[model samples]
Target: MPAAINPPVVLVLGASGLLGRAVHHTLLESLPHGVVVVGTGHSRARGLIPCDVTDETTLREFLAAQAPRVVVNCVAERRPDVVEKEDAKARVLNVRLVEILAEESARLGFYLLHISTDYVFDGTKPPYKPGDDPHPLNAYGEQKLASEKVLRGEDSGERVRPGQGSREEKQGGWDKVWTEVLYGPSADLAESSVTLLARDVLAPLRSSQKKVDDWAARYATHTEDVARVVTAMVDRALTGAGELRGTFHYSSKERSQDLSREEGGEQRPGQGGGRAYTKYSISVLIGEVLGRATKHLEPEASPPEGAPRPQDCELDISALQEALGEEATRSRALRDGLREVLQALAANRMPPPPSSAARLRLLLAGLSARQKSLALPGAFNGLVARAVAHAGFEATYVSGAGVAAGMGLPDVGLAGLEDMTRVIRDVSACSGLPLLADADTGGEGGEGGVRRVVMEYQRAGAAALHVEDQVFPKRCGHLEGKELVPADEFALKVQAAARARDEGQVAGEEGGGNGGLMICARTDARSVVGVEEVIERAKRYVDAGADMIFPEGLCSGDEFLRVSQALKGYNGVNGGEGPYLLANMTEFGKTPLLSVRRMGALGYHATIFPMTLFRWAMRGVLEALEELREGGRVSKTALREGRLLTRQETYELLGYTPGRVWEYPNANAYSRRKGTRRSDFVQEGKEVMEEEDENEASGYGEENPKKK
Candidate 1:
């Protein structure tokens, strides 16, 4: 009988660290059963073999004994601050360890796969290729660069390197992989920069504000992704498909600041290449996931202290893609990866909140259920949006009239796309609820304008928006003298909006999913033409790809029922699928003030109280000013009796905890100085007043008998 053959050994160095553990596990899962995988670390934990690779004598002895066919070098002192503090000791592990490994690989005849960093580049010029000139800015980068030189035969004449020197000079078989900032499941928060920021820095400051660096841009890549790249290369080499012998780059496309070169150095607040998050932005997202307010978490525009970092070191992974194909080089999205880290940290106590896509799907589900007509109160500002969410409503609306009134403008199409989108962003961010915005007449530029509205509204976080058929400088839907665009012209605009929505979904733009941004066509034709004309135009709009129909200025519940019954029965271009119907229940409008139940009874999927909260809020403002003017003092009674929103209530509504130190002096113009407590003002208005019943004081609980 022939002697039993031993399996080819694959050794992993530094297998206890975040990236090392990922590589070890990936190799175990990816390699064939014939391969023997062994992982060694400085410490014996997680079943990793204990060996200090920095010591050349011990490393050589271990490698000789194992006689591994392939060796993956994951050993590095990754933290910049720690590397900066102990340069000599860090150099032993980061640079010298690789030198020894290269020499040993030449002797042992093993293929060496070495992991490097994006820090080798200065970061001023980005999307760095493997052949790009490196200008390391700090000690950590300098050491990693030195290691690369050692592997490339630039360090000494005697040392051998891959893809370089004469055949006689070439000794070791090797490949170098360059990667960027890494984060993944680890033993502790300190193991990764992302988790450290979230758990150590941001989580403890629930009531206080913390400033984070937003200047240095980074591509936060997952370690598991890098590990998979290593695994793929190993598999290819083992199968003789190809040799992994050249310098390659592997990094995530998720960037910190994805602004175009033309956008210049300064980034305006809330503007960037879509969904790219900076460190400050990452903190804000973590706060959102934790249900904490990041209002106080400010962005420091300057560079951070300790260890100089490159501005942007985004790696170009084309080489890896060419070698391993596109699927092997693909990266997980930043938010999705962060969610996994957070879930591990929280022990799965907190599930990720609904994404924009999920919220849009929820809205579509609600519309389809037909159990009740969704009550959508108009939110003119972010605070109002918060109140709407807190009131247990399914969703909210950004009414054109309400937004115009809030901006001190009339509702005759004076407010443009920017004005409506500004409020849409605020409402969506604050409420985290699906929003329906009013795009009045789709602005001034015709079909292009309609497309812009769809794209911008989707970016601004609106789940849906309605474009009206009324002409430019249009009157409110309830007002007289409103002129309608030609039915064909309006249908063209609707088609443009629908096409833009489809394009955005395909491009993976914000709020993109199967439902996408719902395009509702609002026909002001009820007043301009007739009820029959309204129904006919509704069918045309449905054919034009409007997801829903908004019949404006219907004078009675009967007209609403008539339109709903007609549209529901008519089979249009949408393959017999009936469009969701919306009814306007604006105050002082041509339509009667129909209750939610009554709207559902009339077969409408939704009913909008376009100016309800705005009207109520303005009335309170007027009454308060009048009382102050007549009495020469504000009503202490209102404050003491909780008739107005108290400071605590206001903070709670804004997702903030009160009694913390307020850092921004300009945040409250009423405050005398910086760091003033919120309770300081409440202490001044402590005079006792006659308190009303809880329902009356809080303006909740009992329903109004007059409405009934």
Candidate 2:
């Protein structure tokens, strides 16, 4: 059955921020249908409809404009010093904005999502939970706690009811209904710049007995994890399984240390009682949010007293773990992440590969199950992840087709390495699959070229990559229009890729250098030379240290069988330790799509899936764009549903608050967006140069379309 009608239109107030962007990305990929997500801000996005969160009039206008069913707020600033110094400004954003967004959501009968901070609790207890009382230490945390009280509070002082608390046709005020922080992400990497400086300066000196940089890692949230929570929430809401609301922690799922029990069940006296505040062992207000531990300073006999030694930051994040899922939990397991990332780089792969995972396993696991077997280095990307999820699949293919065809752009190296990296990042985000991507000509010519490309790819994440010895304007793997860079140069590139792949894996002091990029040397020699010489060049290429060989443009089954048998022997002097080879079988290309099981039966270990996602993505985007133009509003149907955002939704993501000058509409300001004067106005035009079409000027239905 289809999801019911009247799906909530989530309005995001601020759509641009680390967490906001991450959340938006998650929503786009995971949310269900019937969810309308609109956005509001100074800018617009593919799935976001912009609006101003601080402007009550504009907020209402947009609210009525989209008739939102939900409004999520992830915006906040709980910095104590910032708040104390600018309390008035801070309240506008952190406190006032929350009330405003909530009120609007309630008026429209939409679910309100407001993301809060961990700073709400003072350092009075250890392992504070959600139900614990909160006694904020500073202005920022206090304000955050205060806002929570407002949401949970009964009508009291300054309730601002219309006509003096006697309800009679109210215009705008507050609401009692709201959702709480369901999850959050790594906060250690950000907002703790100060903490990091100290650690960097303190830790090294302590190590050398020379001097230490004052710095320490903190327990904070990862934006990616936060996004997962948002998506999960949407999924639950769409499925009618979302009962968890109010204030829920959006942290990890690890079992945290139990809260310490003192006389007041707290160490500090000023802290209030019974608010369910989360308490870490020590002060959780270290440098970053998900820094992960409480810091301790290395005590030395008073530190030589010159420039005082820097202090370590004190922070923790175990409380967050108890609330997140396994995958979403923050792990210190950097090795696994690095390994998966390295494998992807070596394979030259992408996700949504050529053949389905099942087929790949059946036809292309390895080249011939007999004595002549094709060895495939581990693959990475979505293919492997999908195979694991679906089961029964063994071989992997990279999505070059998805990259090219999906963008509706030619795959002739037009999209730079960054484009490819972005695809791999998304594909690798969840799928722990090993993949081989199509790296045209090692991204240049020489081995140095290979090193540069492979190094970056490793950082971006890939199992392996295929660097075809092809010239400029390289055609599709199965197409005829292509040329090869000299075999020797290509061979050098392959070796370089091998080196880079290794370095990338052991990043950060352990790997000697920044090694860990992997490369699969590919050769189109088969297509150019007749069948026999193909083996000759393949041998020379393999001799030059190719991790895996991708011999493109092989014909029929007989041809595949022979090629598979040709390069069967010859390993480097390291005994049988030679590079593994793979097969490229793309449908509608020169090569026929061999089943993975069949390939495995033959001699191919892995299959390269290029251009699949690119094609599908292109078709979908083109269709969606055309529909939006015709309808005057973008279609949320084709978009990853449940993730569709509205204006209010954006605000939360951007950490929007009434204090943010960019947000509020002002009747008093002389230099505000809504004030008497304007700081800057967007230069909207057809082509950043062309004016709106003349047809748009004459109030045509296409331009303004009357309200139904």
Candidate 3:
């Protein structure tokens, strides 16, 4: 049987402070399995003990009872103003309390660790050492130094001069020396200031702001990095890895650029006495990491108000570097340290909504994956879109022919680019499906017209669009007597679509990127020229940066297979793993109605059932109208009854509730129950009215029932 093991308890004093909380979270996330960590603070807080450090009697009793394996003292009277006013209380809290803890550590045989500051030395020195002579100029520093003296036994008396303590004393010849300076949150050299700057930079960066400031400065370590170092040191002591008992110092290194710069520029008297200094500002560093855009930053020769004012507070970490070797320096890398801080900040940060371009790219990428999928046709009107979405379809096809039929017009390219975009927008708002739009010849104006069409469709929240090579007055794919544009002309239109997607005016929310905009090249040449010409045109379109090849009028599985095989070696413009093949399986079209499973077997990645639902809906409407004309009203048969989508179903599909209407007596109550405010819901009424108009104009609205 294995021997029983009592988990070691690590107690952290002042756990409610910024540094303490950082250490607590880090240890909780990164510590070993058998180590238990507890935190105590002066005030009662979640995950913190309300033990007062000034009350030595209660503190001693608590320490004696708990008897933690390791006691890390983070408590101190750090506020300079408070220390200056209440010197006695500061002495008791910072110095005398440390003495009591040191005594307790000896009695309990626990490794006592205390945090000390760099302010123990006057600013006259640059990079002070662990053995540096104390010359604190302020009460806060004096109390901190006094605490260090008592902990080290440099002055064993109950009281000693401020700044008179050293860690040279050990009760049982065990060194208990640990001190820090200018300590704070990781890479948080500029605290709330960085947050405000981040806010100001966000909008401009999104708008492609270009400006760079000539900023430079030293780097700060992340709290997690420092915490890792401390944890490693503790682990070393526990495991007897090396001599970690004696005085040792640790601080993050400066940036390579800061180090490479000459240190012999100029120095003011009383600044420091190490070397002639060349301290550059760090605005560039903040700009580069925080905003991800350096041009937006404007550098200045002098430090701005409330900027990093110190000429140099660099610490010599050679001793620590030599002790831990690579492990010590690895975690303190400046870029990694900065990222760690940003990552932590982002965890607490609520990110802005994703841009339309990003959403489009993600949808395209999802479609390009190895799995085969079907593109079920949805009406241009919001009515059919809701029905399609409720039917559990993954994606929706906004077919030009389907839209023309919904508008009660022939599919003769009657709707302009703007009209189609409006239909796409209406459908997109009501349905959660990623829409694949049909951009026939990209609207009249040659390549430039095609570019605008592609840009506008992406802006209208279309995930993908197929630009066909049909002539100006192009008919529906299933219709006879369709004229085809020349191969080169079609290829230019494809290139223009690609260019618009990649270099067009992307929305501000999306930032500038061609990603998430899927472009497919649809060739109508299969019917006009032949299957061979369609394959040839598709290859040309692929080379022109089309993401997928949509071959129109494929008569059979054999025709679809031949086209897929010819494009086997071709890759998408976006560096996709393989070529994407989209087969149009429109009912009453040249292509046969093949299931998604059958399409996959023929090497087709996606199949579109464009006009399938529209054909069924039109047949049902014709029968219902005939029944109304003959029987004095629509028949109450299964076909007519099923066609009548209930008012409740329509409301539910439109994401509406009776409590949403302001006229409802309990409208506010419903908002409260949903944890939403009425103000946030005010715009919902307008959107619903807009959707109703769109449906009515498209002749799909069945009038929602009036409330009683």
Candidate 4:
């Protein structure tokens, strides 16, 4: 009788990580019946054979014991931050380990499928073919590129090639595969960016805002897709059907769409799955899948901090497609992949919407506990607010003047409740910072108007709103001819605003008082009446339930101090919490420009840089216009010199991801509902199409007149 033939052994190193686990599972499911698969991991807890690939003795011993036909090497420190922090250690695993594997493969004659990264490229120019010159930006990429060199024999001066023998005899050799931004099932969410985002970023968005990098373009590939490709290559190599050699790129391509029916015969890059995504866009997709509002997630348009990352290291996968066909190289859509991940994470439970009241409380706490005055820079629009947030301001100010100027109107109360509320909503949405909006004179409709303005601003998500004592059609507090209403009448309006805020608070809600909305009463009486009367009216406003006082148009630091002292003294006398004192440090204002520290030292809680950014922005616009008119065009050199916001910077500021759909956090619920209905409609349509096809095949519709 013929001796029993043993099955070929396939070894998977680093089988505990996101990619390793996937490749191991895929080989188990896809390989021919006689192929035996063995997975080894550094840790025994994951049920993988405890074998540290970094230990040359242990690895070689394991290899000799298994006598494997194929070795899928998935071990590497992939985190850019970790790799940067521990360069020497990472190099040992990333490069040295590969060198060992290559040597082992050449000797043992086992096919080695090594995993690489798209980070081998500098990412400046993308769709990088395998032959493209490598220029890694960070230590992680540098090490990955080094490992590839080792495999290609450039480092060792001995090209590692497949062993020449019979198909059955030459079961082991070496090849390299590159992939990008892998994400899929893992025991730990931190193992993959996609899972980390779902579990860490989107899940906790209710209490805190998160900033995700939206500048770097990434092709998020699912680990499962990569696993299938690895399995297929291994199967081919073992079966001797094909030879897998050279460096190959494997990435999840954005799905192609048929644009033949599209108007203008053109389709946007974001309309299909072939498009790259920024981290922000990925977060948006995750949010949609989780049914969570992404309003609390701000897109950082700039490159992320820590290790340097490539901007767009999109790998060109033509080699993989050519070798395996389109179906084999195809990847799951990002959303669909995320849905699977989210399901594994928490059964796809939706996180609660971010709380506006919580943001207001954050502002209040910041003002109350700040060692220095909280500087609130005025943001006229959402873009400006995003800039403010990026600048690291604790809170933002929606200046009435800034808003009015943006609308091409004068700051004479022409920007009414609707106007101010519009800006408030925009700034709140974009900045994700506590906002203090300017409500001039609380509109012209007296106490009722004041109440309406308060409610509207509160609903618009303003953490605080300040109503000045100046009459309707009010002049800029710093400008001349500013008139104040009667102290009693203005006090009534302040009382009405405060009451409206309190009434709007939801009962039984956490930190519910006034829904965390602060009503700051601004006394313009410093210019109209006197500093003494300014203090008097401020006291009256506070007594009428104002949460803060803005002493507008105070001419000197002495006056600011006096008003602040008076308010503090009044609070002492009243024996309860006193209203926060706010100082206006607007440029060219009657008030002297005081540093935030100086204001804090003088007992002020907050300071507003109203119109500061707006003024600077306007000056920039004028300069650009003048340069254009004089030179017939602005010089590219001038533009590149950081004199203007770059197109990429503008996109970042706007949180606009090119080649992706715009995600509105506020409309997430509607979008999810619509998506469900659309999916159902498509499924139903497919069913109908199937029925019609069956009838056609059965001749049911061809001659129904005989039955009739």
For candidate 4, the 10 contiguous residues with the lowest summed lDDT are 676-685
TM-score of each: 0.47, 0.37, 0.46, 0.48
On the 0 to 100 scale, the lDDT of residue 218 in model 2 is: 22
Give the RMSD in angstroms, all C-alphas superposed, for model 2: 21.7
- Local accuracy of candidate 3 as per-residue lDDT tens digits, 1-708: 232244566677876665566666556555664465666653322234457678878889878645566777767776666788888978998888888877776666667666766656664566766676767767887887777777666776564322232422332112333333223342122232322243333322444453322232233444455666666666664555643665566655544443343357543221223222221123344445553434554435454332123334455566767777767544444444444454444332212223333433433333333244555565667667766665545567898887777777887888778778877776665554567898877877787787778767876667778988888788888778999888888888888877777775555313234545678889888888899998888888888878788988889889988887788656534343345678888777677888887887677766777777888877888877887888887556844557786788777666567764322112222222343322221122222222322212121121222331
Each candidate: what lDDT?
A: 0.73, 0.46, 0.60, 0.71
Task: Quote model 3's TM-score.
Answer: 0.46
Per-residue CA lDDT of model 4 for 561-608, tens digit only, reads 787767764653212335778888888766778898898778787888
Q: Can you rank all candidates by lDDT, best first?
A: 1, 4, 3, 2
Model 1 scores worst on lDDT over the 10 consecutive residues at 663-672
Query: In candidate 3, residue 472 scores what lDDT?
Result: 78
Question: lDDT by residue for model 1 over 502-552, one digit each (tens)?
Answer: 776334345443447888899988888899989989989988888789989
- Model 3 lowest lDDT segment of ten: 694-703
* Clash numbers, per candidate: 0, 169, 16, 10
How many residue-pair clashes does candidate 3 contain? 16
